[model samples]
Target: MAGSQGPLVLGPMLRYIGETDATVWVETAEPGVVTVKADGREWRAPTFSVMGHHYALVVVDGLAPGDELPYAVRFGDVVVWPLADSRFPPPRIRTIDRSRPTRLLFGSCRTSVPHDREGNSSNGVDALRALALALADGEEAWPDVVAFLGDQVYADATSEAMRDFIAERRDITQPPGEEIKDYEEYAHLYGLAWSDEAIRWLLSTLPSCMIFDDHDIRDDWNTSWTWQEEINQTSWWHERLMGGLSAYWVYQHLGNLPPAELARDEVYAQVLAAGSGDGAEGSGIDLTEPVFDLSRRVDRHPEVYRWSYRRELGDCRLVVVDSRAARVLDPDRRSMLDPDEMAWLDEQLTGDVEHLFIGTSLPFLLPPGLHDFEAIDEVLAQGAHGRLVAAAAERARQTIDLEHWAAFNEGFAEVFDMVIDVARGNRGRAPSTVLFLSGDVHNSYVAEVTDAAARHGAQSRIVQAVCSPIRNPMPRVVRVLMSAFARSLVRPMHFIAARSRRVPDPAFPWLVTDGPWFDNCLAEATIQGPDVAIVWRGGEVRDGDDLHPVLTTVGAVRIPGGLDDGARAGESAADGRPTVAR
Candidate 1:
């Protein structure tokens, strides 16, 4: 809020960066003309409202690939960014240049903790802040884009700041008081998440894409039908669901679409039609009712609106999946994604690119043992066991968050086939590698399919990379449980469960090659030609300035491109196994 002389509150943050165009999304203090000026050009978009909150998505046109555009926003001559005479550099937007190497920074599960002694001591260093400072060292080899895989902010897990705001607004003694209650509270939550100076500058400059996981609304969101039924009976659930989805559309999802898609957005078109100034020449009309209605419908029937988005960044393609929202929750046919969403994903899940990056907030590839555990849990919960055992299985499943791809056997089979088919070159000129970029379990690791014959069948290398909790580290007890799960004999149990349920074995046998790093971390990917490389880094305060966390290597992996046929037949995952740090 330093640049408070103007109406802008949270952004001028760049989004949806493409070859010829870019989007700058902002939250304003009032509804009025919101403009983005850059490279001696501008695109004016009027501020639109949802339940009294104001926002604008300004689309800037006429740029070439690899264009370095430094943009600023204004509301009626009031400059809202860079503050007058500020020493900080102007926020920049670097469009994707396909000819150049593609680098993406991804991580998830962040809490807005204060960058001080207490927060660091409790939750470890804020890795995203460390990444910003790391990039500040030089322009050399900076990421072209950053994909926030999931849980960019914890709506369910409130920070002290968010708690304070809630305490001020409502009685803390009331039920569900600490969690976000409405769209207004969600707005405040976002402000808290984005206000840190270093992170703010980083967001304003970096072309960021986001997908939400459980904590974005609540932990274990959409985990199961039973859990959903229990939560729906709560008094505040309706308001919370409505606010989270509505605020998400304005703050996160709207910017995910391209200009052509944005043009097709009916609500957005309404705002565009609104005049660009005060009262918009009598066209300044409130759009609260329509916006709220849309939010409600999307929350109740997520299948109606597609939140999943894809970006073709040069030779690398990034597909961000809406795993949490688009669920087919029938007891008999449970799926993480409904049929339509799965079909849409199938279309995007292809070859032809040097690297195919699948961005599911929840890792599509879990540890083999955990994968089986979930599968077994699903089977038992579905009454493969006795009725009493089935009820117990359901309770345990909700408690441990065993609601991943393996739990939805049908959906898992679909994606497994899709990945295998794409890798086998059935879809197109197979990508040199197919990498699943994900975060959600609050740990970082690398896993790859190890089925030798499957590798022989695949023309492209397939791997899973995960980075989680950029700020919110898992508790010690949970870490112990995760480690135990990683080392369990659930594989044999899973084999039995799959047999009992008549579920086929996975198309590819997989193993976790690198790590299960529990530190707050961020991961980066670099794709050059047929070779793709990934590294996970965490932040540690090992110096005099305890505030600025130092970046430390967690683990790294390298997958060579052009695995066409049996080039890497003997090797399981990449070169031997993934290189481990610790």
Candidate 2:
């Protein structure tokens, strides 16, 4: 039965759709059986509570491949979904078709705000909303999956609505201020981030996968050892970290796993096995303490829980790495991934698929100039120039956000060697392209190792494509700086790198192939047989219609299905600008 409170709270988000089974995750108003009906079949799951918030992850099984069936969600006996006035079509579940090409949408760092004119003017139009509108109108074809790389919610950067909610419960003058503090606050923040009708409808129908970045907890989260020690001393860090991790498990991470892995999850099983409370609307097995304890334990030992995951979609392998967590923060030997995580990733990075997509929140291959800078900074901060210089370098590292794959040179080289192995057909049959798909720099770009199949003798096209800020745009000055680095700093950086004893010469020299575009946009990468193509799109409000912005392509590039043909396959547009490849 639907309760006095609304039947649905946040979602009926479609997550991890496979050939036979799919998951629909929802936050309900109460502890009720959430049902999903499609193609004359119904599947139901019981709601589990976390800090009084109820949720269900209904596994709809036994679907035929490539089946597109309209679905509805019911709360007990009441039909509670499709709202009654939804402007979009009824949500449908489309199972994966292995024989067909794979299309994926990816981006990161969206801030929750109103979709009004003012919000659009301030933060640019919401690219996700634009995509949703376009999809509803049948303008854009549906993607197989939407991989949200990181920063799904900015916990530190509160919007007006979030601030109001915070002020209602706590003293805004206190430590952490408007920033979220606990699981309850995180619940509300997620509601704000996903409750927009257009984006909500989009999420309900499209299969989405997500990971967390720094902004999901705070800016510069897990940047370095010093950062960890400083943040640990804060009066509120424990609650914030526990709440963020717990809420993440409930909201984002749980749905990331396939049905089998989800079933095997120990914490999920514990919640399900706990005692149900007295059949009340909001009463059930509350997992507040259990999840909090799980979060705390993982904080103490990150190896206990791996946030990194892998998906085998058709002829493509999508490996989403947990770049923020599982870091070796030791100053003497800093690495992006700890030893255990690295071992796991090593096993997953082998190539046999048509295309291999590594979805890391941090870019694995930065622009060469920027990459050299970060590598040099890492050594300087590690006492390459004595204690006082090292201290200054450490301060600069945090101040300028110099944390990326380049900062962890050892980890970078280890992965680079593995990629080289894969590209050289040492691991398996070489992929047509090895793409590092990333999104955290608040800009979009495509970079490639420019060498002939003759010169490098590699089979795959090694590439890095980044898309970010599905809503939040970077400042104008920062954009200019990034553009300058791409344009003029490569030779100068090479000279600087030659002088540094700690920095190793790269096996393959690379350069930016397409963009440094700072538009708040989403990138679509489609792998068809042996070729891959990428297009970056943003929202454009036209004729004062802020409510329904048009989805416009900002830039596009196509990687032909073949070996490296010298500079032929990697050439840019004739006019030296990003073009929409028709």
Off by over 4 Å in 1: 1-6, 85-87, 275-285, 452-456, 487-504, 570-574, 578-582
Give the Cα error of residue 97 in candidate 2, in Å. Answer: 0.9
Which lDDT tens digits does candidate 1 get at residues 1-582?
Answer: 322235778777788889888898887878777767788877777777777767777788888889887778788678788667754578877887878899889999888878898888888888888888877766336788889888887888798888888898899787687888888888888888887878878888888999888888898898888889999999999888888887888888888889888878877767656654432332245777776788788877877788899998998898888888898777799988898899899999987888899999998888777887787788788887689988998999988888988888788888888988898888988888789999999888877766433344887777888998788889889887676555454456555646664544676677776677898888888886788788878788876576777788877778776564545444546457432210
For model 1, the run of ten residues with the poorest summed lDDT: 276-285
Note the Cα lDDT for every prediction shown: 0.80, 0.85
For model 2, the superposed segments whose C-alpha errors exceed 4 Å read 1-5, 271-283, 564-582
Best candidate, TM-score-wise?
A: 2
lDDT of 2 by residue, 253-292 (tens): 9999997887688787764455243222332667778888
